[model samples]
Target: MDRIAILKLNGFLLVTIQVEMHDQLVLRLQDDLTQMLERTRASGVLIDISGLDIVDSFIGRSLAQIAAIARVMNAATVLVGMKPAVAITMVELGMSLAGVRTAVNVDKGMVLLHEAAGLEAR
Candidate 1:
């Protein structure tokens, strides 16, 4: 797995992960994302997953968990850049992402976040 990248901008946090789609990556992401949410006290989180081509059960569950945690932290989480093929595969596998918000791309996700947080996009 590659290093996870995190950036903070305008009270929103962006996380990018470049790694194999696997259980370990999901666990690490959970920990890292949880910490980021708590430490930043962010209004929203944008997760970019354009690099990932596959979405497994473990990864999907981890994402759901992250969204839940963000809510508890008083922040909204938006998943962005999901590939169409990966989306189809996830649906076929009966993996339901409960309590998770998704956008077609990062720009849309940022807009959603801004609306959710009642902030004007700059």
Candidate 2:
């Protein structure tokens, strides 16, 4: 997998992962995210999943875990660009992403992250 793109915008770190949606990639992404959160002291995070075709349990779990860790690190995490089919399947599978915020697009996700972090758009 290629190195994920991390962009900082309006107090949020936007991460665009360029890999197949799989367990291993998700775990690696999670580790990188955790380190990024800790090192950057970012106020929020937005994960753009627009390139992903499917989201498996492991990937979902990794996202949730990342959100949890981000909160502890004083950052909010939002998942963006979830495909409709994948969202439906996740809902049907009863997969709970309790603490993670989600949005239909990167723009919306950034807005959510900013709102959660009390950051005014610049």
Best prediction by TM-score? 1
Score every model by TM-score.
0.92, 0.90
Model 1: clashing residue pairs? none
Report lDDT per candidate: 0.85, 0.80
Which residue segments of model 1 deviate by more than 4 Å?
none
lDDT of 2 at 67: 86
Q: State each candidate's clash count.
A: 0, 0
Candidate with top lDDT is: 1
Residues forming the 10-long window of minimal summed lDDT in candidate 2: 2-11
Off by over 4 Å in 2: none
